[model samples]
Target: MSGSSKVKDGVSGLEFKISQISKNPPSLLVTLKNNNPSLPFTILKWNTPLDPQATNLGLFKLVDEETGKEIPMDGLKVNRLIPPSKEDLVTVAPGTEEAHEIVMNKPWLPEKRPASYNVTVSGKFSGVWEKYGDDLQASDLEAYLDSPFSGKSFTSNEVSMRVE
Candidate 1:
């Protein structure tokens, strides 16, 4: 969560949390009220990354597993980051064989809902720009999840999100 705490099997060990979810199905259903009024239809929730204390590349959305020609929510937003829990993640959330080499997750989204999920990694900018910038296409789910870019790596770089 903080810095790349430990390098394992050629990749950084990491975990991520749900930054925000853009829509709420029940609210977005457009209910007919007594006054015939519409109200807010979205909600946001927070999480303590599955693993509490694994340190890795701060937080970088490792190209989502769901692939397609979908556009990213916020390009100019630089990058979304999360705060490190300071607890040891290894014991809380054990590492896997496959993920031992790759540092990403595929969150299973609910069905029949129009929602956008933004995962806040543990770090700030610099890396997202240096890695996913230039090629705006890299921000694309499909492109970022494809070959080459999918295997992209950076030097021992670290960035912190200065919450102002």
Candidate 2:
């Protein structure tokens, strides 16, 4: 390791906040054409790339933009990786970009109300360790990750309008 590499092992964590919502973003747009409220909206997340050997991590949180309430993890119906069985893997190199798409399942929310969502980084290492998968087998480790690493607060977006 001679030259300065912008890529660091700790870089695999998400320091920035994550919020996915369009201001006046067409929350109520429908795929039916001339329809009200979109049937199913999705949440997309890009975490710092990391190896797949890390501990239990990865899951974007959902919050009510207005109520400041933390939505249940169940509502987050999608994931990037489901470890222990082998799967989720990304590198935390300079340009490494890991992503996750979570579908919003708040059917109880009014079809035309304002809401917001914020992403939560659930690990100390940004879960971006490039050697996570390999590390899974290794006994020696050198890092500390607190539970519930990072979280962005509720933002503001709207649901589709009622189709009359």
Candidate 3:
């Protein structure tokens, strides 16, 4: 499934897509495309679901279509005391896309398989740096934080899959 969202300011937009890579163990490939022609888009890697360390089970919502119940995710939640650093940011260059693969195993998925399931990516992109500290000051970083894409919540199109 694919979903796209245009920022309110029309300065940037993002296209998100999800495709099933495997069925037996259940894996998914997520792709993100930057629509801006001149500027690169930045996303908080710690909050983005595309990163496995970002808590994939919590960021991606999974529901059983037959039972109409949301599947519970068992995972650890990490809380950082300090603000996000430059390393925590992912940049998608102008008119470019990036992809990542997620393997859903025991903790993310129950031992028993559901007949059918619907999955959607949902999360908020947020983080601000009051002090650049040792990090390099760039115009692109300032532009991204000032843009409408910052601190925005997004939900992708729901994709349904059948489990045998």
Candidate 4:
């Protein structure tokens, strides 16, 4: 996965892969793996914007490869730009991986969509900075705590899946 910036932490070292979990419900499994040894990295949960961990959880879009048209995704809400309240960190140990399975239901991907479509996820992983200022409280620090000092932006390779 390529990022917007260059980071040395394991965040940039994450490897992404997508698979077709099921064709009946139209689901996809997205996995993030930490390829760096001796360096532990955290990824943001489903919400919270602009932080290191948060950067890794991105949005998914479907593209019709046959017609070159973009499919409208419904039921998928946009990310809220709320202030960081709690720290939802997923730590991946060296050579470990985490998977998120997405079920494409109505609005998100209608039950009757085209057969040839490619799924792409837009986002990146980030490395944490070593220094933390005293003025920042724990919650405040949560926003910048694992802030991306250097990292890469990620755009997943399109994985083709079809509806049964």
- Steric clashes per prediction: 5, 15, 0, 12
Off by over 4 Å in 4: 1-11, 47-58, 74-87, 111-114, 124-141, 149-152
Error (Å) of candidate 4 at residue 68 is 1.9
Write the number of the candidate with greater lDDT, choosing between 2 and 4.
4
Candidate 2: C-alpha RMSD after superposition: 14.1
Model 4, 22-100: lDDT tens per residue? Answer: 8877877777766776666555444322233322333566777777888764333446444433444455677787777
Identify the candidate with maximal lDDT: 3
TM-score of each: 0.17, 0.33, 0.73, 0.66
Clashes of 4: 12
Q: Which stretches of candidate 2 lie over 4 Å from their true place?
A: 1-17, 21-63, 69-85, 106-112, 117-164
What lDDT score goes with residue 59 in model 3?
A: 80
lDDT of 2: 0.28
**Could you give me the TM-score of model 1 versus the true structure?**
0.17
Candidate 3 Cα errors over 4 Å, as ranges: 1-12, 74-76, 81-83, 127-148
Residues 8-93, candidate 3: write the lDDT tens digits.
Answer: 43223566667778886677777877766776666656566665474443787788888899988755677743445577666677
Whole-model lDDT values for every prediction: 0.23, 0.28, 0.63, 0.55
Candidate 3, run of 10 with poorest lDDT: 127-136
- List ranges where model 1 is wrong by over 4 Å: 1-4, 10-134, 138-140, 147-164
Error of 2 at 26 (Å): 10
